[model samples]
Target: MSKMIFVNLPVTDLGASTRFYEALGATRNPHFSNENAACMMLTDTIGVMILTHDYYRNFTQRPIADAKATSQMLLAVTVGERAEVDRVLEAASAKGGRADPNPAQDHGSMFSRSVEDPDGHVWEIFWMDPAAVPGDSSTVDA
Candidate 1:
């Protein structure tokens, strides 16, 4: 079986976060959604679970940082083409999210754009060309 990636993030409100992610082209997985949390399926292999602060705190004893003022993690998702990056960012902004105020990277072979969810979770939508990617390294410096 292929490995699936799941991202767990803390949100102040579940419904608001769901709407924010939905606007970014993610569909909610009813199987994992509830009042305390919602599973946002970004793709077949990539999924994000946005949980309320109270619910997420149950998983750990450490304090969870308020993402709006402090960044906990940055979520990066790839696309097949650079256009998809803009498409996703636009959709997100339309739903109250904000686009990162910086130009996308153009490493000759790859391109990317970024957005911040309502809760301040950062997601980078990018496109990569296999031919341009380094053979020995999984990622480029750019």
Candidate 2:
């Protein structure tokens, strides 16, 4: 069997978090959702489980940190093109997300920007030209 990934985030408001993810093109997966958690489908193999703070606490003994005050992690997403990267950043801002917590990055073959969801979880939206990969002479296009 293939591997699947599920990123779990603690949210203060499940409803708001659900709307936030929906704005970013994620769909709701009813098969794995309930009152305390919303399963957001990012792709066939990837999902984000936005759990209420109380619900999330059940899984960890440590107290949940305030994401608004400190960053716990940065989740990255890739798009087809640089324009699409910019597009998602803009879409994020329009949908009540915070954009550009850090300056944009350009590494010749790759470009990336960061956006934070309503709950302050950072998501890196990026585009990379695999053909232009650096240091891998065998695969990189001339």
Candidate 3:
């Protein structure tokens, strides 16, 4: 059996968040979806469960930090190529999401773009070429 990762997030609106995720090329897994939450399947191994604030609050006794004010985590996902990175981020931006709130970064072998969801969750879409990684460890700047 293979282990699957589920990224749970607190959203203000399930429907809107579902639309936002769908724009980013994720499909809702109806089998695990309900009025309180939507299961967005990005890949067979990776999935995101966007739950309403009330539903998510039940999982933690600590106060939920407003994502817009404080960034708790940055969700980074790699795509196949540089073009794909742009495709996903573009769709996110078109659907009432934001793009690159921070400075854009491009390290020759890797390119990364960021987007902020309606709830202010940061998603970083990046592409990397394994062969491009510097191999001489000793020579690398410490």
Candidate 4:
């Protein structure tokens, strides 16, 4: 079976965060969703788990970082084309997310933009021409 990834994020408002992800074209997986958490599937293999701050604390003892005020990590998603990157940033902004939290990156063969979710988590949406990459062809799809 192909490997899958599930990124968990702590959110202040579960419903709003869920809606934001939906606007980005992710589908909610009811089978893995409930009052405290919602599993948003970005693709067949990539999922984002939105958990309430309280619930998220169950998995960690450290204080939750206020994503809006601090930086923890930057998450990225790659689309099939350059236009899709712009489309994603627009959708994110429409759903209460902050668009272009960081400057957009354009390197001819690649393009990327950043957007922050309602909770301040940054997501970088990008696209790259596989043909322009120097690595083995098998590694280009990611």
Which candidate has the top score in lDDT? 4
Indicate whether candidate 3 or candidate 4 has the larger TM-score. Answer: 4
Q: Which window of ten consecutive residues has the lowest lDDT sum in model 1?
A: 133-142
Q: Candidate 4: lDDT of 134?
A: 83
How big is the RMSD of model 3? Answer: 4.0
RMSD of 4: 1.8
Evaluate residue 108 in candidate 3 and report its C-alpha lDDT on the 0 to 100 scale: 87
What lDDT tens digits, residue by residue, belong to model 1 across residues 49-123?
Answer: 999999999999999876667766667887777678788889888887889744678786788888888788878
Q: Could you report the Cα RMSD, in angstroms, for every candidate shown?
A: 2.8, 3.6, 4.0, 1.8
Q: Model 2: which residue pairs collide? A: none
Candidate 1 clashing pairs, residues 3+ apart or interchain: none
Question: After superposition, which runs of candidate 1 have C-alpha atoms over 4 Å from their true positions?
Answer: 101-103, 134-142
RMSD in angstroms between candidate 2 and the native structure over all alpha carbons: 3.6
Global lDDT for candidate 3? 0.87
Report clashes for each candidate as comma-separated counts. Answer: 0, 0, 0, 0
> Per-candidate TM vs. native?
0.85, 0.88, 0.89, 0.93
Output the better candidate (1/3) by TM-score. 3
Off by over 4 Å in 4: 140-142
Reference-based lDDT, each prediction: 0.83, 0.87, 0.87, 0.93
Candidate 4's TM-score reads: 0.93
Kindly report which residue stretches of model 3 are placed more than 4 angstroms away from their true locations once superposed. Answer: 133-142
lDDT of 3 by residue, 1-142 (tens): 6799999999998887898899887889999999999999999989999999999988998887788899878988888888888899999898867999766679988899998899999898898876776795334364
Model 4 clashing-pair count:
0
Worst 10 residues of 4 by lDDT: 133-142
